[model samples]
Target: MSSSFERYQKRRLISSYFSVVLSVFLVLFLLGLLGLFVINSKKLSDDFKEQIPMSVYFKDQANDSILKAFGEQLQKSAFVKTDTFVSKETAASKHKDIIGEDFMQFLGFNPLQNSYDIHLKADYVEGDSIKKIERKFKENRMISDIVYDKHLVDLVNNNIKKITFYILIITGFLALIAVLLINSSMRLSIYSNRFIIKTMQMVGATKSFIRKPFIMRSIKLGVIGAVLAIVAIIGVLVYIDSQLPNLGVLDDKLMIGSVLLGVLALGVLISWFSTFFATQKFLNLRTDDLY
Candidate 1:
């Protein structure tokens, strides 16, 4: 009977440890997902900003040689990511294809002017920055007009700001919840061994000596949990990439390493702190109060 009871207790302890590990894994996995989303959001925003196109039209009298030199200069500008010079003939051909008829034939002349289709760097796509770029470009004698959808630029900037604000709020709230849930799991696991803690204290063992084993156990569990969470997060990223190949979620290795390291550190810290406090609580209690 004694051996059977001992076996049951050992199994129960193992079960309790497993429960704690599983709980920690789930919480950290959630936090990891949020971190992934936050990191990817910045990249996605920049990609969108860089896709907004603008055109710099040249004066009708500007010759091909002058336009080619201007194009080379534009390419060297810090603000420009890419620029393509569209000659008058090419522009007319594109318009003709789009309209399904030769507008040049109907009008008896090609009226399209030579222009450079410019895509600005993401940082310079905002309203004020674009205005500065426009002013600088218009200073050139060969350039006639700089045209872009100013309203669209403003709208994209405004919407991205709103999205960023909401993401920050959501991230903060989710992080708080993750910490609370992990701490609670650790506390409950420690609570089950309260009597053992009290017994160790009553036997004249130093508090640090008594707490050492439990702290070490918690740390081991924390590492296991963090490793499991990281595996789960990688699986999720893989699934997302499969479904949305263009997202390129797994392309940023540095961010992924940072998030994984952060999750591991958080798990160990939370587990150590929670276990320390919970063990201390029972150690300070009177023998009768343990009931």
Candidate 2:
């Protein structure tokens, strides 16, 4: 009977430890996902912004030197992420691809004008800013006309703003949920050892002395669980990088590193507080309460 009782207690302790680890892993995973979205929001915006090109048309008098100078100027401009100067021949080829005929051959001259195709910085790709940019371009003497999709700019900006707002809200809510869950798990684990805590108090052990071991153990468990979860998060990034190379934006090292550090700090702090409180509760309880 003595042996059976000891075995049962050993199994129960092991089960409690596993339970705490699983809980911490799940919470950290959720937080990792939220961090990924928040950190890579810029990459998300740039992906769409690059697809919508802004064209700056040139005058009849514009030559290779003029176009080259303009390209060099744009390269230094904060508004420009990338720019390409398209000559008349290249424009004609693009037209051929679209119209399914060499219109230049039929008309005896290329009607398309030379132009600069520019992609704006992600932050500058908005409706009002794009219009202001067009006006800014028109101030130059060499530029004849500028064209871009006003509606698309509006759509992209609006969608990005909405996504940012929702992600923030969800992150806060989930973080709260994670804390509450870890607290409950810690409470339950401590509750199982309530009699031990009470018996130690009955002896010569002071409150602080008894509290030390439980808190230390909890801290260790928390750290182990957090480290495991961080490994899982890194594994997730590696898997995505290999399987969906198109989503490379998800691999921002600084952001992932920040999230990992945050998880470690949160896990240790939460475990410390939960263990302290749980031990405190049992310490003050009456002897009959142990039953």
Candidate 3:
């Protein structure tokens, strides 16, 4: 009968420990997923910016020297990520490739003018910035027109702002849920040890002495749970990176390291506070309540 009681007590202790670990793992994994989304969004923004080119078309019968100089000037601009000078022949070749016919041959004269294809940096991809850049090119006599997809720029920027805002709200709400879940789990674990806590108090044990062992045990469990959560996150990231090769955000080591550190700190901090508060409640309870 004595051995059976001991086995039952051991099983109960294991069950309480599993409960704490499971709560922490679920919270940390969700947080890790949020971190990945934040990192990947930045990369996606840059990719979209590259797709809109700032095109500068040269005037009809413009001097070759002036066009060449303009191409050099474009390369010197801080906002220019890349620039390509499109001569009449090169433009004709591009059109032929697109339409599968030589329009210049049908028209007897190539109507296409020389142009410069300027790819701007991510920071200068907005409508206002692109407008300012266009005005700058208009001052040059050799340029005929500057063209780009203004609607596309506005659409991408506005949608990105909305997405970022919604993600922040969702993450904050989830964080509060995580805290409440972990705290409830910790309180239940402490409730099981109420008899031990009251017996310690009866023996003249100080509150600090009673709390020390529980705090230490909580920290250990928190670290273990964090490690397990990180392992699971890594597995999911690997599968995602394989399926989506274009998501270079997954390759960012520094950001991912910081995220992992945050997870570890959050897990440990929450566990420590939960254990401390739960122990305090048990200490303050009446002896009759322990029954």
Candidate 4:
């Protein structure tokens, strides 16, 4: 009867420890996912910024030769990524599609002017650089005007900055909370085994000797938990990709691997430090406090 009771108690303790470890891992994994989003959002914002259009309207008298020369010059500009020429005919065709065939027919001759659709590099989308580019475009004899939605560009940049700031603040707060929670859970787990620690200390065990096994155990637990969390995260990513095909494009396999490795390293590091501190605290506690 006594042996059976001891076995049951041991099993319960092991179960509790495992549960706490699992909880710590889940919390860390969630934090990792949040970190991933914060990193990738900036990338997505930059990608969109690179695609913003900058339209250069040509003079009515500008012939294809002059327009082509202007395009070549524009291509050589530091800000330009690529420039595409949209002739009057192409412009008319687009307008006809938009306003219907009869509406275009009423305007006997094509009234649309030729233009160059320019895509700038992401870094040059700022107000100062765009203004500089505009000035350069106006210097060209064949170019009449440069048109772009400045308001939309400003709005996008402002929103991205605001979002980045908020995400950084939130990430910092969440990380602090996660660390505290994990530390508390680890302390409790160690506290449950305080008597065993005390017994070893009483038998002439040095502090390092007492700390070694606990550290090793914590590391093992952390590794197991991290692996489980990574598996779960991968499953979640796979499901999301299935539901939203576009999400698959955002899936950087190398980045995902790095995140997984980082999570594992974090788990091991946090667990080791938490266990060491918790064990040290108990080691310094008075015998009377044990009860």
Candidate 5:
């Protein structure tokens, strides 16, 4: 009968410990997932910005060799990602296809000018950087005018900034909630051992002595939970990569490593602080409060 009761008590202790670990793992996992999204959002924004093209039309008198050499020079520029040279003939043909008839034939001559559609690097796609690039390009005598949708540029920049700000706010809020939840879990787990804590104090065990074991145990649980969360995050990334091979965001090893390290540190730090405070509460409690 005595051994059966001991076994039952041991089972109950294990169950409580498992519950605390599970709570930490789930919270950290959710936080890590959001971190992934936040990191990738910047990459997606840059990709969209890089797609905005600047069209450069040359003067009608500009010869083919002069334009070809100029296009090669533009391709070598630091700001240029790619430059697509469109001859008068190609533009007219494409315009004809779009309008469902040969407008050039009706007009008796091709009105289209030779041009290059240049996609700038994301860093140079901003308003000031684009202005600088335009000034530099217009200095070339062969170039007549540089054109791009100024409204679209402004819209993309403004919208991305707003989106990033909101996501940051949401992430910070969720992080605070995660901390509160983990702290509560730790406190409840300690609460179950209130009587044992009191008894240790009554036996003349120093506060530090009593706390050392509990702190170590909690830290061990925290490490286990963090490791479990990291593993789960990796599995999720693998599944996402398999389904969407084009999502190159997972290739950012440094960002992923930073997030994982943060989770591990948070788990350990929160656990230690939560356990220390919870144990301190019971240690200072009067015997009457133990009831």
Candidate 6:
């Protein structure tokens, strides 16, 4: 009967340990996913910013020299990422392709204006910055008019900012909830092992001596859980990259490495803190309250 009781107690402790580890894994998985979102959100925003076009139309009478000088000046500007000078003939051919050969016959000469197709720096995509850029172009004598889709630029900037902020808030809240839930679950697990802790205490063990084993176990579980979460995250990223090679977001090795490190650190920190606090609570509990 004594042997059977000891076996049963060992089984219970094993079960509690497994339960705590499983809970930690689930929480770490969620935290890893959140970290991925935070990293990729910035990448996606930059991709969209690159797509916003700001075109500067040139006067019909403007000479090639003036256009060339203007192009060089624009290239040197802080806002411009890249600029291509589209000649009147090239613009006309593109326009003709759109409207067809029959539409071109009605024109006496090529009516399409020469222009510079400009891609601005990511930071200049906002409405105020773009307006300032447009004003600078208007000051140029060779510029006919600056043409850009204002509404589209505004919509893209606004949407990206709003979505990023929303995701950040939601992810933060979910992470907090995950930490709290994991902490509670770990506390319950440690509480079930209260007898073992009590036995150590009765043997004149110091508080630190009794807590050492549980803390070590927690750290081990945390490291294992972090590794598993990183593997899962990598699998997801690989699948995504295969499907969308143009994502460009996942191509950054440094960013991805940082995110993985962050997830690992978060897992270890949360587990250590949770277990430490839980064990401290159990140590303080009255003998009668151990149940």
lDDT of 3 by residue, 1-291 (tens): 999999999999999999999999999889887987777787788878977888889988688889888878877899899999899889999999999999988699988989988899988998888889888989997788888989899998999899999999989998998889988988888898999999999999999999999988888888888888888888888888888877765678888889988889999999999999999999999998778
lDDT of each: 0.89, 0.87, 0.88, 0.83, 0.90, 0.82
Best model number under lDDT: 5
lDDT of 1 at 144: 88
Assess every candidate by TM-score: 0.94, 0.92, 0.95, 0.92, 0.92, 0.93
Candidate 2: where is the Cα deviation over 4 Å? Answer: 249-251
Q: RMSD in angstroms, candidate 4?
A: 1.9
| lDDT of residue 47 for candidate 6 | 69
Predicted candidate 4 versus true structure: per-residue lDDT over 18-78, tens digit per residue: 8767766787778778767766776678778888999998889898789888878877788
Error of 3 at 247 (Å): 1.7
Flag regions of model 1 displaced more than 4 Å: none
Per-residue lDDT tens digits for candidate 1, residues 135-235, read 98888899988889999899999998998899889888977877787677778778878888888888899999999998999999999999999999999
Q: What lDDT tens digits, residue by residue, belong to model 6 across residues 1-291?
A: 999999998998778777666776777777777777777777778767878777788887899898888988987798888888888888877877887774457766777788999998888888898898888888888788888889988888888879888988988887888789778767877877888888888789999988888888887777777788889888888888899888865778897888889878877888889989999888888888887
lDDT per residue (tens digit) for residues 110-195 in model 2: 87889988998877888778788888889889899998988888888888889888988999999898888888888888999898
Clashes of each: 0, 0, 0, 0, 0, 0
Off by over 4 Å in 6: 1-11
With a 3 Å backbone cut-off (N, CA, C), the pairs that clash in candidate 2 are: none
The deviation in Å at residue 73 for candidate 3 is 1.8
**For model 6, what is the C-alpha lDDT against the true structure?**
0.82
Scanning candidate 2 in windows of ten residues, the lowest lDDT window is 247-256
Task: Report the C-alpha displacement of residue 263, candidate 1, in angstroms.
Answer: 1.3
Candidate 1 has what TM-score? Answer: 0.94
